[model samples]
Target chain A: MMSWLGETWAILSKEWRCELRSRYALSTVLLFAITTLIAVSISVGPAGATPEQRPLMPVLLWLILLFAATAGLPRTFVHEEETHTADPLRLAARPSCLFCGKTLYNLTLLLVLEAVVTPLFLVLLQVEVADLWSFAIALLVGGVGLAVGSTLIAAMVAQARARGPLFAVLAFPILLPLLKLVIDASFVAVAGEAQSPALGLAVLYDSMVTVASLMLFPVVWNP
Target chain B: MTIKQKTFRWLLFVWLAATIWAAFFYAPLSQGFAGKMGDAPQSSRIVFFHVPLAVASFFAFLVAAAWSGVYLWKRRSIDDHRAVAAIEVGMLYCVLATVTGAVWSKVQWGAYWNWDPRQSSIVLALLYYGAYLSLRGAVEDSEVRARLSAVYAVLGFVVAPFLFFILPRMASFSLHPTPGSAEMDREIGLVVVAAIAGFTALFCWIASLRRRVLDLNAEAG
Candidate 1:
């Protein structure tokens, strides 16, 4: 078990090293995120927006995060296939180990994105959270759900003909339920409602997707 | 077709015919406001067909997921054929259910698309299976397609309960009736049961026929 985890860690570090050198995924995702945030902030200009628009901030934030994650996460596997490194990687690591490594990398990338985007969103949208703990939990759990979902979907579509559109099309439906929960949790956190059941649902969604992705990744990875 | 298969198909056809007759002729109109629509409650008749299609779609997904699991475990081409066949038929039923439900909603609620939880969830389900089909089409290799789609089918199936059942219930307000809230009269209930049974048989027959056609095409190729 220790060796298995070590192998996964090695693969994760290797991915990070490659990413650091290229900075392709990170830059693309961050650029897209910042652009969307600015556009939204300008269009909905923090001060002039009506009261009805307050509830929509969470939805907008999630949508930006979701699209940004979709833009970036597929590179985890697609990069390997694109550079013809997939074969060597497949040979070197067990399918499960590779999945673990990719999933961990995706999760880390998403957390980093949230760290940057969430504060900016609050500032730009002038959104307030009554319960900071609940809001943070929502972002954390929701980020995990998004990462797990997109990582598995990225692996599935990595070898497909239309990998780009296919990734979003496939990931959106899978992520809808989790997104709904997270959005609701965010709404509640903003509304000052004693942290609602949405947080529990988000946690449940995260665990379920994480487990399902782990179990199903071997088949997608090998094929 | 074998004699047994032919007989089964005939029986399914007859059962479906009877269900249609009973649904229109025998099932009592829904009570209250639904029964009062257009002075004759003709719109309520949609339920006899609509609810059964939804139920059958659910069953069809279960069939697809089951066959997918078998295919993954055994790697049989026939199981893959059956799995995709069930999804195709289920997609048809799901679309019909959505259209019929929309019609019913327009008549009952004065709007066709209410973004009701049930309505949204069905759309989500359609997209989920639609993605599966797209995935199948996108992959060129036959074995790889079968394997990957099977995995997707299994994973999608595991998620279905949460998508269809749990999430919809979490919505605090919806126009659709919640379970245990709407009471069906005995006659309508019986007709609905018959319609469900007929639709199940029809789904099975169509899926089997689809599998045979797939096998024939494979052989020819």
Candidate 2:
């Protein structure tokens, strides 16, 4: 178990090094998030949501992050295949370790994305949080769930012909429930704490999907 | 066409014919709610077919996922074929469910499209299976296609509950009924069960035929 964790760490560090060197995925994802944010903020303008629209900000925030994820996260797996590094990596790393490392990497990237876009959303879109604690936990847990899901899907889609949009098509249905939970969590956070189970539910969803991803990863990663 | 199989086919046709008859003529008119022709007996009749189509499609997806899990374990091309067959047959039923549910929604809720949780969940199921088909189309090798889609089907198994169960229930504002079985009249409930059984059998028949076609195609190739 210790060795497995160590191997996972190794893969994650390698991912960081490669990612930093290329700056390919992070840049694309961040730019997409920022671009979407800017366009949306420009549309919504100085005035935030109308008084009747209670859940608009959280909905918009999560949608931006979700779209940005689709724009970039698949690159984590697709790049390995494109670089012809997949075969060596396949032989060298255990499937579970590789999946864990890549998921952690993707989680980091998603967090980076959430960090950059979220504050901009707050300032530019003027999204107010009534409960900061739930908001943070929701974002973290949701990001973790999306990261794990995208990692498995990335591996699946990596082997296919149409790599890019196909990733979103496959990822959307699977990620949507988790997305809803997080959105609700964010809503409750903004709606002033109604004691929502959305956060707990998101945690449960993340654990379930994470376990399923781990069990299914070897089949996806292997030929 | 063995004698037994032929008889079974004819029986299915007659059984379905009987279900239609019972749904329309035999079953009591459902007490409709407040609306124009919400008093209409036909309003309740949609339940017979609508419930069955949704139930069958859900079963179809379950079978697909089950076959997919088996395929991953056994590495049999046939299991993959079964999974695909179940998905295709289930997709048709799922679409029918969505459409029928929509028409009923218009009658009852006064909207063809409400983005109701039920509607959203079914559309997502369509997309989920549609993505499965697309993923299969994208892969060149049969072995790899079977492998990856099987994994995906299993992952979908993980997601299906959230789509079918969690999303709609959270809305709590859904106009759809919750296990109306208890409140359902005996005759209507019986016909609904009959319809569900009929549709499920039809699903199996269609799926088996699809599997056979794949087997033949594989053999020819």
Candidate 3:
């Protein structure tokens, strides 16, 4: 387990270094996220938006995450393909190990996106942030759900036709439950309503998806 | 005729007769969760059909997943056929379940759509599996289609527990009754069990039919 964690960390750091050096995925994601946040804030209006309108925040946040993750997924494998290194890597390492590595990297990328956007969202949308700690916790739980689901789906849809939109088509319905929970958690967190219960529920969603992906990744990743 | 086909047919006929009898005769006609709880303003006798269809959807997906595992493991043409056949039948059952659930919602909730967790999840399940079938239909290459569809089937099965089970438990506004609470009475439980059995037998019969159809297609190819 320790070795697996070490390998996963290695993959995560490698992906970070690669993204930082090239700025391909990170730059696109940051640009897209910031643009979308600005657009949503304008649409909601700086002065007009209120707590009743806050449900829209979670929805818009996930929409951004969905698009950003979809855009980032192809990069995850495309970089490997362009370098022509995946074959040697897969031949040398366990596929489960590879999946673990990829999942960590994907999670890191998603977390980075969330970290940048959450504060921007709070400032732009005037979110109350019932408890700063709980809000952060909710974001962490919700982000992990999106990360793992996106990783598995990205792998599945990578080789298929129309990988771009097909990822959304395939991933959206499967993601509704998690999205719903995240929205609910954020709504409660921002409104200062049912904070504990809502966060707990979000945790439930995260655990369910995490356990499922852990069990099933090896099946799809391995030959 | 193959031994499997002959035995399956005989069993099918027997279960068909049994379901007809139990659904029409043995199942009780409750006025609503017995007396006070039966608030639907009408008889709750639709339980037989609704419960059966719901259970059949579960059984159908189980078959789909099992066959998918076989296809992925063996990479055989016949297993691919089985996997596709099960999914088609599962989609059929899922549709029936959704329709019946809609009707029940209309009667019980005073509207056809309540945005209840179970209702929403069932609709999502139907759409998801429908997309699965659509994916299959879009691809022309038999081998690529088979392999990709198998992967999607496995993913659907993995993500489904979260969609159907965990999410519902977390939500607050759902009007649908939660399973396995003290609210359940013995009569409802017994009828639900009988419905499950009846529907499962029906599911097995239809799956057998679909499998035979697939076998025929394979042979002709």
Candidate 4:
């Protein structure tokens, strides 16, 4: 088990190192996120929504995250293909471990993005975070779930002929439940409602999905 | 006639008899909503068949995905053909399920399409698989198409829980009633179960036929 953990960690670190050196995925994801948010804000209006209705801010924030993830995530795998790196990586480690590593790496990147964007979202959208801890916790749950789902989906779509646009279309319906949970949690966090049940539900979703993906990825990433 | 063909014909006959008997007598008619249909006689009859067909279609999809996984894991060409056959059969069932569900929903909910979670999710499934087949057609090379479709199939499974399970739970706005045997009542449940049995048998039969068809196409070409 520890050896497996080491393998997973090694793969995760390798991906992180690769991304950091290139700065490709983070920059594209961030650029897309910022541009989408600006478009959303403009489309919604400069004056902004009322406070009572401010709960919608989290929904909007996650939507931006969703679109940004959709737009930028395929690059994560495509880079691998372009470099012809996945072949070597697959040969060295178990495919299952590789999937775990990739998922963790993707999840971490999303968390970093959320970490940076959440506060910015709060200020720009005029969302009152009743409890900062709970707010972050909910986003974390949603982020991890989104990360696992999108990472696998992005890998799948990246292999297809039309990489970028196909990823968005394919990922949207499948990620609807996670988006719904995120929207609901965001509502609870903003409205100062009891955070326990909503947050708990999101966590349950994350755990179930994470475990399923871990087991399923071996077959999915079959060489 | 050969024994295999005889057995197949017998199975087909039994399935047809079971389906007809179950639909008419075993399953009781559910009363439609108050005004639109006005408690019309024979209105609740469709529920028995509709629910069963939808469930059978879902079962076919599960089989398709599982087969696709096997194809990738074993890296066998035949498994790919099996997966494709199951998906095609599943797609047929899915269409019938949607049409029946829509018709049933119109009777119960006063709308032809209620953005109800179950209805919406079924539509999503249809669209996802539809796009999948389209992708299969668009790509020319057999190996490439197989590889790409296998990936899409696996990804489709990953996202399924979110659409079918999660969104519906989260959507407070949906008017779709809670799912259960109780919703349909004992009489309805029994009929639906019988119909489901019939549909399952039919699905297997159709899958075998489709497999043979594909082989024949290959031979002819």
Point to the candidate with the largest DockQ: 2
C-alpha DockQ of every model: 0.74, 0.89, 0.34, 0.32
**RMSD in Å for model 3:** 3.8
Candidate 3: CAPRI quality band:
acceptable
- Between prediction 1 and prediction 2, the one with superior lDDT is 2
Model 4 over residues A1-223: C-alpha lDDT tens digits? 9999999899899988988999888998888888877777777666666876586688789888987777666676767766787678667898777878888888888888887777777767666778777778888888888888777766665455666667677667667666777788777777778744567766776777677667655544553
User: Model 1, which residues run further than 4 Å from truth?
Assistant: A46-49, B32-40
Compared with the true structure, all predictions reach lDDT values of 0.88, 0.90, 0.73, 0.74
Per-residue accuracy of model 3 over A4-56 as CA lDDT, tens digit each: 77777777788778778998988888788889889888988867357677767
**Model 2 docking grade:** high
Pick by TM-score: 3 or 4, better one: 4
Q: Kindly indicate the candidate among 1 and 3 with the higher TM-score.
A: 1
Lowest-sum lDDT 10-residue window in model 3 chain A: A214-223
Q: Supply the DockQ value of model 3.
A: 0.34
Q: Is candidate 1 or candidate 4 better by lDDT?
A: 1
Q: Candidate 1: what lDDT?
A: 0.88
Q: Please give the distance, in angstroms, between residue B70's alpha carbon in candidate 4 and its true position after superposition.
A: 4.2
TM-score of 3: 0.83
Ranking by DockQ: 2, 1, 3, 4
lDDT of 2 by residue, A1-223 (tens): 9999999999999999988998989999999999999999889867876666656888889999999999889998998999899999999999999999999999999999999889888888666788888888889999999999999999999999999989999999999999999999889888787897788888989999999999999988887
Of 3 and 4, which scores higher on lDDT?
Answer: 4
